[model samples]
Target chain A: TQLLEQSPQFLSIQEGENLTVYCNSSSVFSSLQWYRQEPGEGPVLLVTVVTGGEVKKLKRLTFQFGDARKDSSLHITAAQPGDTGLYLCAGDSYGNKLVFGAGTILRVKS
Target chain B: SQTIHQWPATLVQPVGSPLSLECTVEGTSNPNLYWYRQAAGRGLQLLFYSVGIGQISSEVPQNLSASRPQDRQFILSSKKLLLSDSGFYLCAWSPPRKLQETQYFGPGTRLLVL
Candidate 1:
């Protein structure tokens, strides 16, 4: 079973458009993280949210951890072509393990 | 500052051939190390993890195995490679004893087993 479920496995948008990707799970996590991966490269950590109902913003990107700690959302404002990549959400399963969602592939056309 | 490295960025092997992929982390000690496989540009499937030397945990049962011979080195090995073993293998590490789980990933090794 997929511990975490991410919506909109693939998305394509025009530059300046806004978009959001979601990660949900029935099990509560100790923490959640967002990562962006370019083709042929390792995924890079974008942000981490630990507390319930915590919201974090990095430039035009926004991340929110659900109040119950079982869900997270990543929103991008005025999306740019440079933002095209695979966006993945991972939940901390403790014991230094993580459960990951299938990830969302976003393509922004300029 | 710590950096993770994976060698032979890409590999192509035949069935029944032996396989070995190495990962090493520099500038850290006693890190929480992990091995993951990614397919179709999607989520990571945790294959194995280790918290210390000579200690390895397998998350999935398969033809592969892992070993940690040194504090900062982790190796994934298989006696006979299978065609199903074709995929991108990734290595990652997190700070020691931190529960928050912010992991840093190394450039992956793409293995194509024929």
Candidate 2:
């Protein structure tokens, strides 16, 4: 089974604080995706990384895929209260399946 | 533009009752459909996925089953409800025939079994 291990399962920070969540795996994947989920709602896709060592940014969020294709990270700069949510990392296994991590719950207090 | 819908939005059922959750996609054809379960604001647990109609892949087998009756419709059913089955059920879709791509999720159904 392909597993993506995510760290800092729970995080709490004040507004304007920075945080980084990591997703690691022993198995290589073709692509990695980041998602943010709110309470009582399905997760919303945030970003997808297809290239090794690739870096993509979306406003205050930065996503990076490891060169080995076995890891990824999501960094949030100057986090606000709206940024508080569950951050999930999913890896596209081989063909049609995706392996998901446990996810990181972030709480940014104002 | 693509949209996915799942209903009923929330459910409350007694144990041993039958369960059926429906998911449908619009503005997209021949899309890949997936069913996932989340434990109260936690990570997702993939239950099943379908590449096409009548083709379902089971990831974690138990009492749950899935079916794709049309290109854009997917259903999750169980003969008997379990207390452990209560959670946030999510449905997602992605473009077909892609090696790797992003998936769009629906609003989700919250199920609670007594």
**Poorest 10 consecutive residues of model 2 chain B by lDDT?**
B95-104
The deviation in Å at residue B36 for candidate 2 is 0.5
Q: What is the TM-score of chain A alone in each candidate?
A: 0.96, 0.98
Which stretch of 10 consecutive residues in model 1 chain A shows the poorest summed lDDT? A91-100
- Residue-level lDDT for A47 in candidate 2: 95
Give the proportion of true interface contacts each model preserves, from 0 to 1: 0.71, 0.78
Per residue, candidate 1 scores C-alpha lDDT tens digits across B1-114 of 899999879999999999999999999989988899999789999899888999898999999999999999999999999999999999999898763488899999999998
TM-score of 1: 0.97
lDDT of 1 by residue, A25-93 (tens): 998888999999998899999999999999999999999999999999999999999999999999986
Proportion of true inter-chain contacts also present in candidate 1 = 0.71
Against the true structure, candidate 2 reaches a TM-score of 0.97
Docking class of 1: medium
Best by DockQ: 2
Clash pairs, model 2 backbone: none
**After superposing candidate 1, which stretches have Cα over 4 Å from the reference?**
A94-96, B98-100
